[model samples]
Target: MQKKLVCNTLKVQWRTAKLLIFAQNLTMGTIMAKESYSAVLITQGEHRFYQLAMPSDVLSSCTFVSTRDEDPDKGFQRLLDKKRAKEIATYIDSGHGTIPTSIILSAQEICGLEYDSRNKTISFEVLSGSFLILDGQHRVFGFKLAETKIRVPVIIYDGLSRRDESRLFIDINSKQRGVPSELLLDIKKQADYENSEEQLFREVFDKMNGDPNSPLFGRLSPSKRVKSKISRVTFNAALKSIYPALTSRTPGEIQEILSEYLASVRDQIIRNGGDENILLNSITFRAIVSFFIHAARRVKDRFGPEYTIDNFDVVLGPLFDNIQIAKLSGTSQSKILDYLEKHFKGEFQL
Candidate 1:
């Protein structure tokens, strides 16, 4: 009697779960529950196999699988505003059932998605009986904003395991080709939702290129796909290495000084009939800045702490006296900055 009761309970649960999946299909106007069924067994001769009959709309339900860590409906609401939701609605309405697989799968595969005007909708299938969002919470929110109805694709699996789902989610995200550092930073920021600083560094390091030996290992590189660790350590180290002469000043003060100096250099470059864009693009500006900081320090150590940028014209010459500044090509920016700072004996003028 107890076994029969337990079997009945299982049956009720299965039915309820099926009803929910079917209801989603009906809401999208793709198929009616009667037309679609799950766990139906087909017998061909002596062979018997269970089959899940999904409609065209079922396949089209491209909405991402919710990660289960958050409530999809509520999470969507939080990530998207009303205005963007309307836009997504319009995109869905125009598509007449055809949606970009890339928009849907890319996010699923890449762990994130960007809003593209060209692509109106992104959809994915449910995993582990739930919809997990690999990416584009904002786009989903935007679609909701537009008040457009979206039918997302989903792959339904029975008895889906959490570990399996997470693995799939991570695998899809990590394999995205040609991801940018900025994008990785954004992902890291999202993954570490609590905004812990250490997690930020780890994610940044994971996304960067080149071996551990690369000077840019913990620093932002010129590559589009790489980023610096940007921890307090790197941040302070960068400032100290660049302007050792300014050691007396606090980190905050050093940042202010560097910001002002860079701004001045930018202005000067523009005024001198130099192509501001080209100057910024070349290593010359960085090299010159390094030279200036180091040279200023050398002057101060030899003379006194009274040295200033005005006196830089005279002091900078000896700092570059033995080294060929012109030949200092292809050197790492950080190295050049460090060498200059050390050589100058911590003497520099803003």
Candidate 2:
């Protein structure tokens, strides 16, 4: 019994020494440093996956597989977008940026992922080319290029067939509808997310849309399907075209000038027995704003510094008599603006 105990003790000592050597190999990066990650296991219909956060540098070490048209046998994933990756890197370095959406990945069976279901964790040894990038190829590369360290949200799937992976890539790219521009504009306002000029123009648009006395009141469409002549995009574009000229002025000053100018145009259209909405049409509005850049200066010079609707009305008197607002339909915005610039130059002899 004493001899048996001695043999058992030696066996235990050998096992402890082997474990110590294995741990030393891990510390030396020979076993590639076994890593454990906490994740939330999500199971849906025959699909199971893990949602977790991983360091960008850790993800950057994984290999990417792209299927090429010229070489059909090459793996699955689209080509890495180097330019987009660089742009994302720049954004990450900008100090107030993050990619909130999870990038999808697939772990090859060779990754030898060991999951502890009871603790909701996964542990794996880092192997060369272990994780296959199924989607967000650029994002992974972007993180690699970024100088900052970030914890990127990751969604990883294991045991998926190559066919299913390709199908998933196709589904994600083709099926998702992007956020509408109008909604984005609205969100930007609530978030106060843009530069001062952008905020200025959007504020001007809001004022014009809401004020009953303004010509644009109730004329701006809030949604993609425009019920009115001026969609938020078109109105913003019109204001943007003239932003440089208005940079010297405040939002209130700019608003007053636009309100007076548009009101004058509306009054002229009404006096000519033409539809006021004709002048309010997006194409016509842009042309008129472009013309205002030149006309405002002439009016301000003649009327001396503080110009009113009557001063603008005098300068625009020849517009209705010579030009037909309805006839401008189907003409491109650039063409209309160019024509009006030339027409006004000759009419006013300026």
Candidate 3:
């Protein structure tokens, strides 16, 4: 069998070589094999083979059908516009001759269409197999509208899986300009595998940085862009370094503390005519929080876990009161925090 195969390959190559030589000499016409010839050659062995081919003119014999009869509650799938659909149909009709077969195949795969024999037409139902819309959905939809006969390339899978389909859909739509941040956040919440606070923070960070729809998507904040400047890490480290007497707290407890600190800062900013620059640009808020945490730890060590900064009017109360005065001095945020820490530590009395 091997010898026979080798002989057959050599014969085919010799024939091809002879044809090339003849074509070179003639420089007029070339020999081409039809689908029948290809089919015959492919099925030469005992193995059964199926060859399906659609002519250029007969390509658009398939019709599209909606899988959902009722209104889709998901709100992910969008309805096609009559004007845009007509434009697409026109483009498909005019550009069919110019567009490459590869692009057409790509369109078919994205739109999810397949050929059916019993129906004697191509249908989206036949292409109901699981496939992702990699790129160019609008163009494909346009083609569907324009041409009566259109050919598209498709990948067929056993069943349509929602998880797999949603992932692909997200990836495709994610590239569109001006995607809303709320939509991305909702998607992240739904798609997130980890439910822990730390995991949630990490996931939010990752998604915000990576997804196009996130407010912090590609833009670099001073803290986010520079590794050494991330306020959260720097503030946490400063607290730990200054107050070695402090112990670790649970994620929930830490979150509550941070939330309260942020709320206080926001309240102060709002009272000051809502100066966004002062609120966001100043590192004082972060530094002050770190100092407060250190002060709280010192109080905790001297007293107990219940001894919070809220109970210390002399320390905590005056620090919040003095923030505006310190900020007005044009002093460095770190310096102001350090001064406050020193005062609380008894180097000087406030």
Candidate scoring better on TM-score of 1 and 2: 2
Q: Between 1 and 2, whose lDDT is larger?
A: 2
Where model 3 places Cα greater than 4 Å from the true spot, the runs are 1-175, 178-183, 198-292, 307-309, 317-350
Q: What tens digits encode model 3's per-residue C-alpha lDDT throughout 275-303?
A: 43343333654565455566556546755
Give candidate 3's root-mean-square deviation (CA, Å).
Answer: 19.6
Candidate 2: give the clashing pairs: none
Candidate 1 — what's its lDDT? 0.43
Q: Over 4 Å off in model 1, which ranges?
A: 1-130, 134-138, 146-159, 179-316, 321-350
Task: Compare candidates 2 and 3 on lDDT and give the better one.
Answer: 2
Ranking of all predicted structures according to lDDT, beginning with the best and ending with the worst: 2, 3, 1
How do the residues 16-126 of candidate 2 rate in per-residue lDDT, one tens digit apiece? 999999899877756775678999999877778899988888888764656665347746556677999999999999998878988888888767777889999987766
**What would the per-residue lDDT of candidate 1 be over residues 1-350, giving only the tens digit for each residue?**
99999999999999999999888876775542222233333355433323333332333233443533466532221333456646555666676434433222222332122222244322223322223444445454444444345444333332224455455456656787665544554455456543434343333334332335322334443324322223333332233344446546543444343443444443444444443343232344455445556554545676675443444435543444533343334446666555556544546444
Give the C-alpha miss distance for residue 300 in model 2, angstroms: 3.6
RMSD of 2: 6.6
Deviation from native of the Cα of residue 290 in model 3, angstroms: 4.7
Per-candidate local distance difference test: 0.43, 0.78, 0.43
